[model samples]
Target: MKNSEPIIKVDHLFYRYEKENVLEDISIEVPKGAFLGIVGPNGSGKSTLLKHLLGLLKIQQGKIQLFGTEIRSFKDWDRIGFVSQKANSFNTGFPATVYEVVLSGLTRKIGLFRFGSREDRKKVDHILESVGMLDFKNRNIGELSGGQQQRVFIARALVSEPDLLILDEPTVGVDAQNVNQFYDMLENLNKELHITLVLVTHDIGVISDKVTHVACLNKNLHFHGSTFEFNALKERDLSSIYGHDVQVITHHH
Candidate 1:
């Protein structure tokens, strides 16, 4: 009952691969418990605007909607939860265990030829005890580390209880003290399971203060909003959204 709409509602977002223009005129909305935080730099388009908001790229000229439909009739793909960035390069000696890789994220909600019940192994043991990895479930997902296999692929993208998760660089190879305890377990799963985060990072000072919104792409949309108005901008507008010389340092724990 916490959805006050706008769980992502881009507009005018243009993408192009055949002739450059990765993402120009991109607009964003987010709302519904947003955590946002999508900085930029390396080739700008921030994973091509998160693969055009997870439809894996198609909307070539504009409008996206997601939780309010219209991402080409967004069929509620298990209410969205994607982890990507090679989601821990599997085939780890082909053995699989951390509770069969977080119960294989419920194979797209329990239907990969149907199996999971015991209430889907108690919802993959309560999402591997909310990503502490439930005491390493049964270990051996190639032995853990790399922040415990990225908290077992974020408990396999939160065992399908997704209400918009979408991570990309998720502390890419973790460890600067586990990337500050993996963004403090993604701010305790966005303030204790309210979800709706959209992180894509180049570590803008480790999500500045655990994000509350702050987009600043490069190919376009050079800044969005809040996180106290993107920390009152201008370190030369974050060094012109990372074309060079960015020196923002505001971490006061």
Candidate 2:
């Protein structure tokens, strides 16, 4: 691959679900080590787009490349880590400790029946420390708060040392007060850990302050640029993207 190749590239993408065109002529690029925040109103095809990136949905009328390889030919799935909204749906009653939960992330890599080696255990501990959940390693997964559980899940994803991390509405069940801290952790992952991040979230104001780039979508890709450029858009421009008047309140850190 060329040195300048983007980690993810979507070109002239189009998708339809039965009668509705869910995405139209969409295109975007995510460079390695960059933090990209995707913001859009509900039913704006954001999830559909993410599915394509994850290679879950077949590409119908567009091209998508991951790590410079076409999605159809990309086989290094382990290089990508995904944290979904379903994390909040995790069975809180499930009998598992935080360490076990994070270690499970390596099941695919280490074989389903094989136990983790000492090296693997150390890796898990390091990942937990990076995510600030090392102290809770012995705690029951069911005992943690939504925010803490999310951090554990992130550590689980990190255990495999993925180069790209994708999150879909990750803060769904987190308390309002802890949302900022959650985003702060994500920022550290992107900045300090140098993991490429593709985040789909509704927290536009908060995300705008953390992400290096922003993409505003509404079936079509309305905006894809630097955070500064996205923040400079007029309210009317943002309203047109959302199909209604909207306000973006930026929070300073």
Candidate 3:
């Protein structure tokens, strides 16, 4: 792919669930190394759009391209890492060490039945350290707090060395106090590791200072621009898109 090409491109996308339209004429481009946040009210089809990007949902109308290749023809699935809200649903009683959990991310590349190589183990350690979970390497996955577990999950995603990382409501179960740190970690991953990031979140205010761009979606894409442009939007404009009174809170670092 060329350096100027967007990592993800969606064009004239539309989706319907039986009778109602879930998404309408959605189009957006996520550039390489960009930290893009997708924000919308509940039932705004944010998750549906993510599913389309991940290839979990087949495209019914629009077209999606990943790594400059059309989604249907794209074969580099390993280049994209995904962390979902369901990461919090892990059984607390499940027995697995943090090290093992992170190491498992290499399963796709390592193939089944074969053990991780020493280099693979080192990669896991590096990823865990990057996510601030290396100290918990030997600890049980079920024993960590919500925020800590999320970090471990992120480590697992990073262990595969994906060029792009997508997170869907990753802070759902994390405490308020740790949310900032969690976002900071994500920002570091985007800036330092140079990994492109696409995050679906309800916390627009919290992520405003961190993300490079924002896409406001409510069935149709209401807005898509730099963080500065998103922040400049009037409350009434947001309210109109939300179909209810809305308030935008911006956090400044």
Each model's lDDT comes to 0.81, 0.92, 0.91
lDDT of 1 by residue, 1-253 (tens): 3468888889989888898898898999999878999988888888988887888788878899987888888888788888765534656575878887778888866766555889988889888888777888887887776777877887888787888888888667666766776787888888988888899988787666888988888889888888888877768878867867888765445
- Model 3 earns a TM-score of 0.96
Residue 68 deviation, candidate 2, in Å?
0.7
1 or 2, greater by lDDT: 2
Candidate 2: residue 86 Cα off by (Å):
2.8
TM for every model, in the order presented, reads 0.34, 0.97, 0.96
**Which 10 consecutive residues of model 3 have the lowest summed lDDT?**
244-253
Per-residue lDDT, model 1, residue 1, is: 36
Misplaced by over 4 Å in model 2 are: none
Q: Report clashes for each candidate as comma-separated counts.
A: 0, 0, 0
Off by over 4 Å in 3: none
Which tens-of-lDDT digit does each residue in 1-253 have in candidate 2? 6758999999999999998999999999999889999999999999999999999999999899999999999999999999997557889899989999999999997877566999999999999998889999999999999999999989988899999999999998999888888899999999899999999999889766899999999999999999999888898999999998888887666
Residue 140 of model 3 has an lDDT of: 98
